[model samples]
Target: MKVHFIAIGGSVMHQLAIALKRKGYIVTGSDDEIFEPARSNLAAEGLLPVADGWFPEKIHKELNSIILGMHAKADNPELLKAKELGLPIYSFPEYIYQESKDKTRVVVGGSHGKTTTTSMIMNVLKSAGKDFDYLVGARLEGFPQSVNITSAPLIVCEGDEYPASTLEKRPKFHFLFPHIAIITGIAWDHINVFPTFDIYLEQFRIFIDKIEPGGVLIYNHTDLVLKQLVEQHPSSVRKIPYGIPQHRIENGITVVTLEGHSGALKVFGEHNLLNLQAAWLACKELGVGPAAFLKGIMAFGGAAKRLELLARNERLNIYRDFAHAPSKVKATMEAVRRQFPDRKLIAVLELHTYSSLNEQFLSEYHGAMDLADKAVVFYSRHALELKRLPPLSPEKVAAGFGKKDLLVLNEKEDLLKWLMEQSYENVNLLLMSSGNYDGLDVAGFANKVS
Candidate 1:
């Protein structure tokens, strides 16, 4: 097969390019801006473009298909040329569906915990020696890439609610008609795209409708909105609801009780426990028993940047997470507090995403950081200008969060200074964001602090 990628420098797009290259498919790609890791990895794989920038002449009739990335605009030159040639163009999700249409697709979807839950299922299946292809959002411990394509009978996908491509405004999950679908939970997000909560929720409804007939839906019953949605929607698929499995924290270790079997887990937090149960149910449908599931999951450390331990000492520990949404921030903060109840937790959040920096959306974070002894919000003025948004004052941020004591910093140096002045003794520091703090080496900073 011959596949050409347009704007393929994205985190997942580059991985998909590599996956296809490894699958022996003639893979070629071009991007105007290629950053680190993607630039290096693609070069190493000999898949990097000869030059940066789109060449409309590169789009030829001989090409089998064009995989478009979200990074490409609608009027992209290469895309225009592909359309002019009458060649088939596919968004990543559409192409994934095309490849796995014959297989039993298990798609894990939700506002939060999708990556972790998808990784858990991948870990269990891989540990059980199951031949399967997967596409997870984050890089896992054992997975060579974020995406794997093969002639396997099963394909597990981390279904995202974000738009699939520049042309496709619908959620990516809507395209994958999963035989087994899981919704970990739902919270309003992507305000830049879905302007209203009702509209955001309607996407999930459409997703449920997209499930194949006689399929199975495993949902988080603990999430009230999800529960109501499932109850209200009459479907042909079988419904199974799961919550946090019986678990207890002992000496900083988390033990989950499954059936009569009990095992310690490397991942903690109520959200993760619920994620585990969701993954367990999906694995059960795929012929993995409770015993095997427990054994496989016992070794699961966690997906990258989802509570990843960066640096730690006897008296201090630092963790980083990809938590930009209000609900996710609250959940992550609560998780750290629960894990180390005795430690004074300091939660630092970076308002980097479009929604997080928006004036209206700022209030959604009210009381989200209440679990932390100290809460701080950081946003760069340059970031606002880049996003084409207006400047936000520190008073506005503090007022939005409804915390008069909230420390809001806009300068990276000032934030660093404040962090350096803090006492790290017996404190748990949680840094949450979908971005780096303006090129701050958080791990190195954590090491210095520790």
Candidate 2:
């Protein structure tokens, strides 16, 4: 099969291209501006475009398919050319569904923890020498690629709720039609796409409806909304709800207890506990026993950037998390506070994504960081400029968050200064952002503070 990619510089898109190439498919791709890792990875695989822009000549009738990345516009030149030639074009999710049509698909979906849960299941499966294809959102420690699709009979996917592509305009998870599915929780997100909380939630409802008949849906029963959704599913579909397992936190470490067996865990927090439970149930449906699941996950550190420990100084610790959503922010803050009750906590977050910077959606973060002794919000004006949104005042951010002393900074220098001046003595600092604080070096800064 010959497959070409438009806007192939995307994180997931480039990985998909490489996966197909490894599958013995003829792969070609183009992007206007390719970044470091994507550019290097594509070049390494000999799949990088000849030039930096679209080439209409590349779109020919002989090509078997064109996979469209979400980064591409609906009227992209390559896309238009492919359409003119009546060539088959598919969004990323659509292509995934096409590949896994014959496999027993397991999709993990939620506003947060989707990547972690998916990676947990993958880690356990790989440890047990299980052969399966997977598409996780983050780079796992042992996984060579974020996506892998081959002749495997089972495929695991981290199902995101974002629109598949500019052309599809459908939530990515809706197309998976998983035989087994998991929802960690539901929190309002993607305000730019869904616009309203109810509209954002309705997508999950559609996802539930898309599950194949006689499939199983595993969810975090702790989440009231997800519990309600599981109850509403058809009788033919089984619902398995899980909550926090028996566990204890000792000296900032969490231990999981299963079937009277206890072991130390690399990952902590109630949210992660629920994530582990959902993963356990999914693994159970796949014929993995409870003991195997517990033993494997004890070594699972985490997916990239989710509560990642960057540096440690005596009694002080600093963490970096890809946590921009309101629900994620709250859970992360609460976790740190609960783990280290005596230590002072400082939470610094960046308003990076479209959903986060949306003025209408700002209120969703109300009291999100209240658990922290100190809360700081940083958003570079350049980011807002690039997003074409109105400049947000610090006052507006403070009001929206409903935290009176919520320090807000628009300049990177000022934010860095504030971080440096903080008393690191017995304080655990959490730096949360979808972006890297406008390219600030996390390790370098953490070292200086330490």
Candidate 3:
């Protein structure tokens, strides 16, 4: 197969390119800008473009398909050329569906926990000697690629509700046609795209409708919204609901308790316990029994940046997490507070994404950081400039969060100064952001406090 990808420097796009290359397809791709990690990863796979930027001539009659990335515009030069040539074109999700049509597709969807849940299933399956293909959003410990489209009969995916591409305006999850689906929970998000809470939630409704007939839909019954949605769709699908598994935290380690058996786990927190339960149900559907799933997940540490430990000592620990949305903030803060109840919790988060920086969306964070003993919000003026949004004042941010004691910082140097001055005795520092503290070395910065 001959395939060309537009805006191929994207995190998922580059991985898809490498996966296709591994599948013995003749793959070529282009991007206007290629950033690190994606650039280096593509180069390592020998899939990076010979040169950056689109080449109109690359879209020729011999090209079998063109896969579009969300980064590309509708009138992108290569996209226009491909359309002019009358060749078959697909968005990322459309192409993924094309490859997995014959397989039993299991999609994990929700506002959060999808990546962790998908990783859990992958780990259990891998350890149980099950052959399956997968496309998880985060880079997992055992998986070589974030996406793998192979000949395996079962395929597990972390289904995101974001748009597929400029050409395909539908949510990516709509195209997956899942034979089994899981919705972790629903919280208002993506203000830039969906605009309203109802509109943002309606996407998941559409996703449930798109599942194949007789497919199973597993969900967190603890979430009222998810429970209501599943109840409304009673006959169309079989519903499986799970909550936090029986577990205990002993001396800072979490252990799962099952019937007549108990096993220690590397990952913890209420959110992860819920994630593990959801994953366990999905794995059971795939024929992995409870015993094997527990054994495998016991070895599963965590996916990247979800409460990732950066530096730790006997009394103090520093961790980084990819938590930007309001839901993510609540879960992440709660996790840290619950894990170390006796320690003084200092939480730092960055408002880097368009949604988080918006004044209208700021109120969603009300009480989200209440669990922290000290809460700090950091954002860069340059990031606001690059995103073409208005500069957010510290007063406005503090007021928006409704946290009178919240400290907000805009300058990186000042934040670093504050960090250096802090004492690390009997405290846990949780640095949470989708973007790194504007390129500050978190480990190096954490070490200074230790």
Candidate 2: which stretches are off by over 4 Å?
A: none
TM-score for each prediction?
A: 0.99, 0.98, 0.98
Candidate 2 residue pairs that clash: none
- C-alpha local distance difference test of each model: 0.93, 0.90, 0.89
Tens-digit per-residue lDDT, 94-115, candidate 2: 9999999999999999999999
How much is 439 displaced in model 2, in angstroms? Answer: 2.3
Ranking of predictions according to lDDT? 1, 2, 3
Considering TM-score, which of the candidate structures 1 and 2 is the better prediction for this target? 1
Q: How accurate is candidate 3 locally (lDDT)?
A: 0.89
Give a tens-digit lDDT track for model 3, residues 1-450: 999999999989999899999999999999999998999999998888889888999899999999999899978999999999999999998999999989999999999999999999999999999989889888798788898988889899989998888977788999999998999999988888899988988898898898899899999999998889778864578888889989989988998975556889988789999999999888888888778988999999899998888888888999889989998899988888888889999999999999999988898998888888888999999889988998788888898888768999998888888888778889999999998778888878877666
- Deviation (Å) of 162 in candidate 2: 0.7
Q: Could you give the C-alpha RMSD of every candidate to the true structure, in order shown?
A: 0.9, 1.2, 1.2
Q: Which candidate has the highest lDDT of all?
A: 1
Best by TM-score: 1
